[model samples]
Target: MIQLIASDMDGTLLDADKKLPPQFPALLEELYRRDITLAIASGRSRTALLSLFGDLAEELIFICDNGACVMQPHDAPIFHNLPDQTIRDVLDLCDTMPDTIPVLCGFHHIYFPENADQAVENEIRRFYLDYHKVPYSALYQTKEPILKIALCNMHGTAAYTAPMIQERFGSQYEIPVSGDYWMDLMCKGITKGAAVQDLQKQLGITPAETMTFGDYENDISMMECAEYSYAMANAPEHVQKYAKHIAPANTENGVVRTICEVLGIHMDSLRKSV
Candidate 1:
């Protein structure tokens, strides 16, 4: 029996407009009634997730910042910060790359260099709720720990930026292409998969009892941690290769639809009159 269900946000749970499914509340309630835990895992921050989940925030498990931080409602959060020197290393690397906007993710807020393009700030704010514009060098001085360092390229990630970062820092950091335009870095062992493993131990559930859905490279780790892993039909070729099954597109409410199927809820039968 599935005890835990986890899904990525951007390309798996949320639609292209970054909106959640309309029937999500009802679906979540049903899952809770069945004693199943819902884990929302994403590269987004806890604050951003709370804003997105609203009333449901306290009821779900959050694996945020690409698993650099994990928080369960009413409990202290577990966090992993990139070493100060590592943060500096990423900043230095960003400096050498033109048109690359670096975002220093912290538990409290996301930070951007004062010189960041206005467009970049707009993009980051779309998913990150608490954020600031500060001198990049000052990041090393902040007392708050750093979660992950992200670089955004308006054109695309897979072409140039992702490769450059991987070649330079892949050995020391976990560099994952988060979306079409962003690549994020954290300490080598920090990943959504690792976070899921931690959560499994804490909840006393095994991989067979977990179900996961994802649509991007960053989500591959979490997909690996669940036996019921599903790749969105709209996911990239690489992403689809890692998952165990395929679901409908995110726009079609694929994640929820799959959950309903797993729980034996027939949509067609429900719509029939008595």
Candidate 2:
């Protein structure tokens, strides 16, 4: 029996417009009734996820910052900090890449350069709600350790930024192309898959009893953590290669539809409940 369901947010669970489906709240109720736990795993920060889910955030687990931080419901967050020198090295690299904007992700705050372009800052605000514009040095002085470093390139990260990052830091860190415009860097062993394994061990839920859905390169490791892994139809062909199954596109409420189908919850009944 499936006991846990973990899903990626952007491109997997959220629609093209980045909005949650209207039936999602009701679906959560159904999952709760069946004693199934839901985890939102994403490159997004904890503050962003909390704001997105509001009150319901307290009930769900969050694998945030590309698994650099994991927060269990009602528990303190588990953080994996990047070494101080590593953070400085990445920032130095970003200095050479003018088009890329680096966002330093700490447990309590997201920090970006005060001189970043306004347009880029506006775009980043959508995912990083609790953020500050400060010198990069401030990141090192913070009480909360830096957990992840996210580089954003509105033009496209996969084609440009990601390749450079991979060539320079691939062996030293876990760099995942999180989205068309974003790539994330974390400690070597930190990944969505590792976070899922930790959760499974704590909850006594095995991979065989877990289900996961994702649509990006960063989600690849996570797909391996579940026996019933699903890649959204909209996911790139390469990303889909990691999944065990294919589901409808996120625009079609694929996550909800697949969950109902796998758990034997009738779609008609779900719609009625909504």
Candidate 3:
């Protein structure tokens, strides 16, 4: 039986517009009735996730900031903070890199440049809720635990910023290209795959009992943690190579649809309950 399901948010669970489907809550209810645990794993912060999930937030597991932080239902989070010196070094790198925007992600807030371009601010708002616009030094000095150091390059992460960061910090950190525009530097051993393993250990679920869906480079590590892995139809060519199967596009509610089909949930019968 599939006891656990973990999915990446952007380009996998959320639609093209970056919004959750209207049917999510109802689907969550059905999954709960079946005793299936759902985990939402994303490079987003927990506070941002809470806003997106609303009242359902407490009921779901969140692998936030690309697994640097994890919060399970009714329990305290398992969180890892970047070393202070590492944070400073990354900050220095971002400050010197042209066209790169660095953001300090924490358990409670995200800190970025107050003087950042308007477009950057708009993009940041799409994923963060309790974000603050602060000077670089101010952000570096924050007291909150630092989950990850995020860098954005509108030109493309894999082709530009990620490679450089990897060359410089690869031995010390896992610099995963989060999306076309984002790269996240986490502690060397930290990854979504590791987070999933931890969850499996906690829930006593084997790899065979877990299913996961994702569509990006960071999601590749997550795919390795599950025996039943699915890459979205819309995923990039490189990303498609990792999964055991392929699901329809996220706009079609692929994750939810696949869950329903696998669990023998009849949508027509579920309409009233939904």
Candidate 4:
């Protein structure tokens, strides 16, 4: 019997239009009726996730900034793995590399560059537009510290500069590429898997009682952490390798279908009986 369900926001739970499925909220309601916990784990910032969720915010635990921040809905943050010196160094690097923008993500707020272009705006929209403007210097001066630093390099140069940057910053700073053009730098212990473990412990749930859904490199640890792991059919092969199950694509209501199937909800209208 599953006690918790943790899912990735972007490619697994959200559909092609980047919207949650029409019927999933009801499905989640059903799960909650059964007294199960629901969590949204993503590389997105906590504020962004909350804004997108809007009214539904109260029913979930948010594991944001790729597991760097974790908290209950509409509540003060309970967890953060912020790195002060690393955020400073990453911001300095972005200054040197003018073509790029370093997005500082934390449980408190999202820091943006002075100005951004269409590509950058599109990137921002993808996370539901949850950022505020702050001076680079003031951003680094934060007493709150930083959970993750996202380097937005639409030119796809982060891969090239990333290795050198990691070498310079050493182990405390780690750069992980999620999209083709974007790279995220996080502290050593801050990862999706680590966050899942934290949630599992808090809820008194174990791997056998947890289920997760995801479709990206950042979702890899989540896919590995849960006993009942599922990789969206739309996921890359590398990410799929982490899951024991493969559901249909996001456009096909995979989450709802898979959960309905697992719970034996029998939604014959939504699927062709085999």
In candidate 4, list every pair of residues with a backbone clash.
Answer: none
lDDT of each prediction vs. the true structure? Answer: 0.87, 0.89, 0.88, 0.77
Which model scores highest in TM-score? 3
Q: What lDDT does model 4 reach?
A: 0.77
- Model 4 TM: 0.87
Number of the candidate with higher TM-score, 2 or 3: 3
TM-score of 2: 0.95
Model 1: per-residue lDDT, tens digit, 47-118?
Answer: 899899998988999999999999998999999999888877777887898778888888888888888777
lDDT of 4 at 103: 80
lDDT, candidate 3, equals: 0.88
Tens digits of per-residue lDDT for model 3, 1-274: 9999999999999998998876788888988989999999999998988888999997899999999999987888889999999988888888888778988898888899887888878888888888889987797788988999888887787887877798889988988888888889999888888899998998899999999999998999989988889999999988889999899999998988887888898766556665
User: Residues 1-274, candidate 4, lDDT per residue (tens digit)?
Assistant: 8888888877788887888877766666777889988889888887788888787778888888887778785667755555576677677877887667788775666777657677876776677355676666676666656678787877774465566566766476545666656677787777888888988887789999998998877788887778899999998898789899998888888887888889787665333322
The 10-residue segment with the lowest total lDDT in model 1: 265-274
Q: How many residue pairs clash per model?
A: 0, 0, 0, 0
Q: Who is ahead in lDDT, 2 or 3?
A: 2
Q: How close is candidate 3 to the true structure, as a TM-score?
A: 0.96
